[model samples]
Target: MTDAERIARVQLARTKGVGPLTYSRFLETYGSGLAALEAFPERVRASGRGELKLYPADKVRREFDETDHIGARIILSGDEDYPELLGHLSPAPPVITVWGNTDLLKKPCVALVGARNASAAAMRIAHDMAHDLGNGGYTVVSGLARGVDTASHNGSLSTGTVAVIAGGIDNIYPAQNEKLRDQIKDTGLVVSESPFGHEPRANDFPRRNRLITGLSLGVVVIEAAQRSGSLISARTALEQGREVMAVPGSPLDNRTRGSNGLIRSGAILVENAEQVIEAIAPAAPSQASLFEMPDDDLDDETLEFSEEDRARIIQALSPTATTIADISLATGIPSRKCAILLVELELEGIAGSLPGGLVRRQN
Candidate 1:
């Protein structure tokens, strides 16, 4: 892509109401970011929403300059170097900033995550598993957090590792891991979907966890409490159709509860790297060909509706999450039209889209 096209992609992504799904739909509808930007106002009006704010060109330009100055590069979804596995996500990130060896992303990867205050035994198991996985030709992927995450990276640093940070590529959280972050930058890879210099907020971690699992062939949970972020990652992995593995911890330990529950729910029970390898081996061939086929072309024709029609669709929605199929049945709208309307509702802040393609009215 040309520099102007690249900048426009970044601008659209930074725009207030344009999320990943919307950005993708815009691309499909307009065929280019510049065209999408030009057409957005009309689209907003058609949604029965007033004028929407377009992201400032100056801000996007400055972001590009800053990324260049910091020696990091932005990888768009269509970029050749973007991870193939991650691109399969329904609402995959439109852009990600990468520092260090982007080539590592091509190798098969397995995510290892667990408790922040991991037990010594759990940490040892994590480190050894990481090392064994690395030797087996899989690049270990993880968030650069404490305990298990840190140990996983340390074990695989010399071989291959990828740290998906919640903050900017330049903003290292857990300040104590500054040295480790630097090591990964120098030797492995550091990735983030946030803008340059942006510090991580409390809510960013779950988003980060998604990328951790999104980029991997599978996820392995070592020791995770019921409410822990590691469980969240495992859940995301399952949602993405990736394998989920867990190490069985002592029944006495609280951290083991979540992982045990996962195994009971059909996650593979794994002990060492060998089991993980075995569990993921069948998936490896398919993942290698994941992006080989073209995605189904989204319908390019824009659906137009009368103001009354729009209101009727809105009235049919409730705060309670409803499936688009049900909405189509209720409103007597075609499924495709229902989808377009839901996207418009999301863009207009009239509705929210949940995982599993459910939608609900926004309060």
Candidate 2:
């Protein structure tokens, strides 16, 4: 990829309505960032999404400038240095900004996430788990929050740790961890989807949680409320087919309630790092070369649909499943055209086909 392509990928990622899935779909349809950048205006026009606004190339070039100014670089998902585990995730970040040792991503990783306001014991558990995991040649992944998140990063600081911050690498929120954040950049790696200087917001936290699990082979939730961010990360791990492990905390402590609940819901109940390492040992050696992308054949230009066919299909699409007959009738398009369009959408990772002749957009 050229510098121009990198700038275009970043621009599309920063664009309105051009999410990871949409950007990827556009790339597939256009075959290159240059082509995608050129085709986007008309693509949105046909889809009736006039509000779609891609970040101007000049502005995104400035973003690259800012990244370089901060001693960071953008890692495209298709790039060799991009985390392979994360690259395979559904609608993964199109591009991630990074600081420090990207080499640490090669080691096996385990995520430790928990309540931001966890108890003393929870902090200790995170610390111990991270320390031992680091000693076992594993990189500990976490958000650098106040309680357990902070403890996890702190403990693994000496060995190896990857801080997947909710905000940009330069904009350290929860200001108290600013120093620790600096230490992480020096020792390990810091990553974020947001451009540099962008502050962390509540909305961005969920996306950040997914990256925590995306980087790890397993996620360990120490202390979380029944519906906390930690559980969200753990759930993402389950979604990504990564192992879900949680420490059994006391039911009485509200902070531990979510992890305990997860334990009951079939997550691995682990007390020490030995359990974590032993559980992962069998698969680790075999999958050591995981950073390599599996599909060398996947290239753009695979998405080709006539405007009439695309319109007919979109008109038929709804939140609920629709049969062939229903789709044909609703779109006023032929059966063959509808089927072909749906296949194209599915291949582009835009939609999923369900059983009994149904289709719906994937989240």
Candidate 3:
């Protein structure tokens, strides 16, 4: 928690290829951010990845300073105030930059996500539901996009709301949401995992969606297309063991297909805020128990990988997702060794990890 430790943690997290999962593992193995950074180069070399690229110390320090100047604060993963529900993510963000009402994060939250080009009826439903939920003592959470997200936040601003942005805490996307963003920053909460001044890219939405669902006790889908980011958030909620709820819509509307599909697939079917509250009420005690961070106590005993072993593991992977267990069986590598090799491959940009412990070739 000291200044030096904060800087080191920021550097390690911002380093290319060291994602949330890898960051947590490094912290567990090295016991400190400074120790992890000092050992990273050697670890990369031992993994057959040659030298690793690290973020510059000066750049991280500058980011920290700018965050302070903007009146926002950086909350590290292990901090006392970090949202406990979010901290339970398998690869929870190592750091989140916040602009306001960090205390709202401790309250029970339900995510309301849906199509950005949503119908008027859907938007009204979302708005009213948000207001009702807020009045009922639940903080509403959503991505700060257009349509449903905007309506959700607007409805709950007077009570409590949380906006998880895809860009940096200060970088407002959709340009139109700038004022709304500022309003939330003043009365509600604005959060982002991205560092200062980083503009959101196409790939950042899914990452941001994960945080939306991760910070909540449950996720409710208002109106989503067959393939949409709202569905992605619902999927993440399911993966995180959070409840998923969906509002049914007319079968004629394409926007309702994804949400309808969710209900068919066992998500709770909800119409009003009362149903949503009823669904999550009984889950409160169990949800509290589920917030325990995943244990990272894999045996730290080093295991060397031969060139052939690495090649075989790579050959076993494809663009199609495969579970780590399947990869281990296919390549005759121990599961733990396969995991280490996969992390190395991820750092090298040769592989990527998907939800549900799945892995796929980056190319």
Candidate 4:
């Protein structure tokens, strides 16, 4: 990809209404970021949305400048160095800023996450398990939160680890972990999908968790409360077709409820690194293929839909989420055409997409 194409991808990602999924669909339809950027204005006009306000070129340039000043590199979705597992996301992140060893992204990875205010026993187990996994040649992946996340990073720093942060590549949260963050940057890798200087909001952490599970072969839960972020990661792992493993704890502790629930719901029960390794070994061979773009040949055809077809699709959507295939079956439209229509609806703020191809009408 050219420099101009890279800038266009960033601009589309930052645009007000274009989300990750929409941005990816745009790439499929237009063949390149530059082509997508050129076609966006007319699509908006045809939608009768009145005026179109795209992300400014000047702002994109400023973002590029700030990233360079911090010695970080921005990798786009189609870049050769982008993680293969992440590319399999229904709508992969279009741009990610990395501060260290990009090569670690190519290796096998496992995510370890749990409660922020975890028990001492749980933290120790996380650390030791991470160390064992690292020695076994798997790069440990986790969000750089507090308790369990911190322990996981500390143990795997020497072998290999990847810290996927919620904030920008330059922003460090929990202030005390600044030194640890720097240490990982030097020896491992620190990743973020947020912009140059963005601080994380409350909702951003769940978004960050998705990336954690997306970059791994499986997720291991040490101790998670009933409604904790670690549980959210396990759910996302299932959605992404990755393995989910949990360490059982005493029934008396509230911290173990979520993990225990996972085991009951068919998640793998693991006590040590060896068990975790055994659980994921069957999946390793299937996940070894690098991400291949659909069709190998980009479909640059500008598919057109009639006004009646648009009305049928919009009518098929309800407040409740439904899959793309269901919508196609109801509307008698082909699946590819249905997907493209949904993408346009999403860009116009008429619909919203969930993981695993679900779409819903936006209120």
Candidate 5:
């Protein structure tokens, strides 16, 4: 994107009703950030959302300055040095505010997510896993929360860590992690999809969860309640078709319920770092296979798709729910054909056909 494009991209991104998916749609039709910005209001009108109140160039310029003053820089997707795996995410964040050794974004990343108030054992597991992963050349990824998240980063600090903050890198929430956040800025990394200097809100956590896994090859849940944020990361990892691992805890501990259930339902059960390592080993070759997957495996493209194909497949489904037949009806493809496409879509990437009739988009 050009300078005007970046500014327009930021404007649409920060707009009230423009989500990443819709933003991508606008870009797809308009073909440039400036064009997309110009077209946003009309799209909003079509959606019956009333007129779009876009951020003017002056305000967005101030935001850019604020981000730079706070020692954060904007990293747009598809940039030369963007985290390669993160770029592959559908409708990935147009830009992120990053602080610290942003270069570490290229390193193999494994997310360790768990309860904000995790148990001592879970915290130790997270720390050890981070250390071992770092030693094995993986940059640990996690939120900058308490418990397992903090422990994971501490263990990987020497090697490297990536914290996807729920708030701006400059606006450290929880207050207790202030010093650690500073340390990460100096050594590891901290990033958020939100604009510069934006504070954390209740809504930011789930959005940040996607980036937590987006930056990593896999996610490991230490100890999480059924409703924990850690589970959010694990689920996102699964949706991304990245490995999902969980550490088992005793059934008595409510904190372990989420992870234990995940394991029971087919998530990789991680007793130690070995399990996590093995699970992501298949992705290692993809390190070179990041952008342009080798065609030598023409019959071998693991699971890939064109954007147009993705849209057609998604349209064939329902938001409430649907089966292969329903998807076929929606897409006008035969059931067998739909299944074949769904299988390919699953292998190439998540087709959003989870067990138990859950039909949705990967996002």
Candidate 6:
């Protein structure tokens, strides 16, 4: 990518209301980030979405300058050095800022994620499992939270580990983890999709978890409650078609509820690193084939939507999430048209897109 295109990509990615899914579709339709930026506003207006608020170019430049000052590198989605497994994500991160060992992202990876306030035994299990998996030739990936996450990073630090953070690449949460974050930055890798200096909000962690699971061949849960973020990661892994494994824990322990439930619902139940390794090995090569985007011969010009069509699509959406196909069926619109409408709706802040092609009303 040229300097101009790279900058344009980041600016496009930072644009308000342009989530990963929309950014990806824009890139696909427009051919390049520069092209997308040039054409997107007119397209938005043409769709009858009054006006789209783009992220300012000045802010994007400042972000890049700050990232350079901190000695980190920004890897765009189509960049060669971007993680192979992560690139498989449908709307993979448009930009990821990294500190240290970008090469680790190329190696096969297994993610170890669990409760931030985990039991001692669970943390120990996660640590040992990560060490064994690392020694067995897989880079360990995890959110840099406390308890289980900290243990996993400690165990894999020497072999290879990638810490995916919720905030900016330079913003360290759990302020206590700052030392550990620096340690990983020196020996392993620290990654973030957020712009420089962006502090994480409560909702950002789930988005961060997507990257954790997206970057791995599989995800293993050490301990997680039914509503925890770790379970969120496991589900995202399943949506991405990556293997999901959970360490069986005592049913009485509240922290184990989600993981045990996963085993009951068809996730692989594993006791140790060996079982985790065996389960994911067979799917490693096959999963690669699943990431390829399908060919779409339909022309964008032919898929145009008018204000009435956009209103109908929006009417089909509710606070509850529904698939694009279902929305298409309900609104008497073609699936492709529904999709295009959703992107416009998303850019207008009328709808939100989730993984697995689900869309929900934003309000």
For this target, which candidate reaches the highest TM-score against the unseen true structure? 4
The total number of steric clashes, by the backbone 3 Å criterion, in model 1 comes to 0
Cα deviation in Å at residue 64, candidate 1? 1.5
Scored against the true structure, residue 129 in model 5 reaches a CA lDDT of 91
Query: For every candidate structure, what is the RMSD over all alpha carbons to the true structure, in angstroms?
Result: 3.5, 5.6, 3.6, 3.0, 8.3, 3.1
Give the Å error, residue 22, model 4. 0.7
lDDT of 1 by residue, 35-135 (tens): 88887787787666776778888888888888889788899999888888877776668999998998898898999999999999999999999999999
Q: Candidate 6, residue 271: CA error in Å?
A: 1.6
Q: Rank the candidate models, highest TM-score first.
A: 4, 1, 6, 3, 2, 5
- Winner on TM-score between 3 and 4 is 4
lDDT tens per residue, model 5, 78-183? 5686777777775567678888787787777889989888888888999999999999888899998999999999998999888898876678777998998888
Model 5 deviation from native, Cα RMSD in Å:
8.3
Which is the winner by TM-score between candidate 1 and candidate 2?
1
Residue pairs in clash, model 1: none
lDDT of prediction 3? 0.86
Error of 3 at 63 (Å): 1.0
In candidate 6, residue 87 scores what lDDT?
A: 76
Which runs in model 3 stand beyond 4 Å of their true positions?
A: 285-342, 349-352, 355-363
Off by over 4 Å in 1: 45-52, 284-303, 315-340, 355-363
lDDT of 3 at 46: 60
Candidate 1 TM-score to native = 0.88
lDDT at residue 189 of model 3 (Cα atoms) = 95
> For residues 92-174, what per-residue lDDT tens digits would candidate 6 score against the true structure?
88899999988897788899999888999999999999999989988999999998999999999889799999899999898
> What TM-score do all the candidates reach, one by one?
0.88, 0.84, 0.86, 0.91, 0.80, 0.88
Tally clashing residue pairs in candidate 4.
0
The models' CA-based lDDT, in order, is 0.84, 0.77, 0.86, 0.85, 0.74, 0.85
